[model samples]
Target: MSMVRAPWRGVKTPGVLRRAPAMVAFCAGLAVLLAGCATAAPSGAGQVADQGFVSGDGSVRTWDPGDRDGPVRVTGTAFDGQEIDTDDWDAEVLVLNTWYAACPPCRAEAPDLAAVAEQLEPDGVRFLGINTEDEAPTAQAFERTFTVPYPSIGDRSGRVVAELNGVVPLQAVPTTVVVDKDGMVAARVIGQIERSTLESLVEDVLAEEEPTGDGS
Candidate 1:
């Protein structure tokens, strides 16, 4: 896996190393092996035995309704051989996560994600996963192991990641994108998300009023 250094231009993480060079080094070290030239970035270098857990820097980027870009177009096959697309998520808040079975941070945060999904789904929030490096069977096993309530798209073909391109710049595994009901990306957590952090972001999105038809 190869790593590229670049300044992440969004919200900033306070206290921790926030300089571009430091962030670049952070991205370089955590790159994961995947098919083609794709490399998944971990949240950081922190790790435990068998669990590459990296605590997130707690950087949250929230965009105003008018500042949101166009809805991201994503389509792929789920691990269960079901076709999935972002278009089907119309009029609902959706959470998109990038992860793989072997990613330590991904493993560590699986339960938190599942817990939040359960709490938010009834409120019209949806959760989707993008398994960056796993095949259907492996990805399915990971979900079962974690008891993840959401279905993940197996991105072995790399098409899904390619599609994400400018939409999210997918710099790290365990990155979370929270889209509002109108399909606008309302917020993003660029690393492993805590339950409280994710929950608070979703609540903020839910509280946003729908776009007014009148030019505001």
Candidate 2:
């Protein structure tokens, strides 16, 4: 009979040396624990109301009504004859208000808008007036008379006013739009916003930043 080597007695076969179920379980548990320890997901909405610039109804609403809608890009020359690019203005919120030197309501609210601008500027809010009807000289004169510190964009084409709400018929003189830092329209105001109302809204928008921490 052929001499047959005795089966290896000391060494175990490959299949016989399988890992223990406990070891596999421990490894899976460890992986899960490590995954759980990773950074938590970001929060949806912060507690602060001011930081929340965009309205729930999907319309940009702000203290100054007569603000523009759609995109927040300010393209063109200001009434002061200064070149204005929405990018250059350093503010988290933009107030785009439409006005005409000839309109009574526009004249009445000019001071209020100016005051709003002065109060909110320190907190990173910009107010831009759009002189939709008047020529450069008239708009300049109006600004001077009202002591409007913020620059006014010249929308002589009536195109910008048409883009805003509550001014479709071209009946309303003062309409405004609030633009969030992302260049998105946050709010729209269709008429004159009282000084107090405008200030409160601006405060609300500014307050939103306290909790969100600049939305970084």
Candidate 3:
């Protein structure tokens, strides 16, 4: 809950896409949550919400080191036609975000994510996007508008989503998964994330000692 402004926090939103949803986006109780989520996303969220993807509450979740899953397996070409294979990345931490061109929360959080990627990429923390929808032009337009600094895989086939099923519930368009050095999911933000919250999550993982392979 750090209120510290990210260096790029002042970035402006486009006039046409400026409708931000409630920050308390998701209902907490499972007893009534599903019913509540049926409503349309924020006006700017996307025209596709009517087609049935649910928006998530900005809830954060994490796994203990002992219970993590994967050295995740997946790969695909990015919007710019760059072939990215996670297996080949020499990063200590990997941040994977599931997004699309027009999700409201996605647009709202873009600047925060851009700043986080800028601040962390140089330190070996890799940020990748698995765009759940959108053609390269729409996705690239979003990236250009937001000044996003990382490459995103064009996951139009849902191939990457299938590959990462248990590690992430990617049905939510703006979900973000933070993977540890061993490629196991360390934390997740189930909706749009606050910059400080994301920074803290990545910093927490970045601070951990590489797991000792002593079979303890």
Candidate 4:
């Protein structure tokens, strides 16, 4: 008697066919992972990483904010006398400019920063000042003198200044960091930026915002 056996019992299909679903899934998952990675940089946003800074024959220092695992925690009073946590301020682009009332460069840049804050308000950017080397009274005076509309976070201990540079030594005043919506540092400018330059940089940052019909 001939035993009836399944015709395809032991025969294997082509490797590609056998693993088609897995391969497809792997490819799909890979695409998703890559997409997530690519989205790290917001579209139309200009990111100036540590590499962008001039090292000046390695004498000029640099820091990788990417290496920073989390947001730099800070607590201070706003110019309006309201307490603020650095994490609580929500905006697409965060401009953190370290200043002191006494520094000439800081004085020079205050108005530019104020203008930037005004121009970017409609575009969902938050411009904040960090008074790293000044007391509250001094900062208040500076704010009043410059007519700074945005809040200034008093960095009495200079920790925020140190953290922003990823532990790199900050030798200059008036350092500015442009942070993306994800709270990652996008660009760092170390010096007084002219009004035109400040405006241009702010425009570049605002350009990254995805337009919404509601002007909220």
Highest lDDT: which candidate?
Answer: 3
What lDDT score is found at residue 206 in candidate 1? 87
Predictions in order: lDDT: 0.67, 0.56, 0.69, 0.55
Ten residues in sequence with the least summed lDDT for candidate 2: 33-42
Write one digit per residue (lDDT tens) for candidate 4, span 1-216. 101111223333223224657556544543332222111122332333243321111111223435422233445667568776656766777777666786655676678788778977877788777765566788889888988988887665444543443422234456666666655455556555556665665566556666766877
Task: Please give, for residues 78-180, the per-residue lDDT of candidate 1 as tens digits.
Answer: 7887777766764368888888888766777789999999988878888889887877788999999989997788765444554453455555666788878
Span of ten consecutive residues with least summed lDDT in model 3: 1-10
Reference-based TM-score, model 4: 0.60
Range of the 10 consecutive residues with the lowest summed lDDT in candidate 1: 1-10
Of 3 and 4, the candidate ranking higher by lDDT = 3
- State how far residue 24 of model 1 sits from its true place (Å): 21
**RMSD, candidate 4, Å:** 20.4
- Candidate 2 lDDT tens digits, 57-85: 11224433334233445566776667777
What TM-score goes with each of the models?
Answer: 0.71, 0.61, 0.72, 0.60
Error of 4 at 197 (Å): 2.1
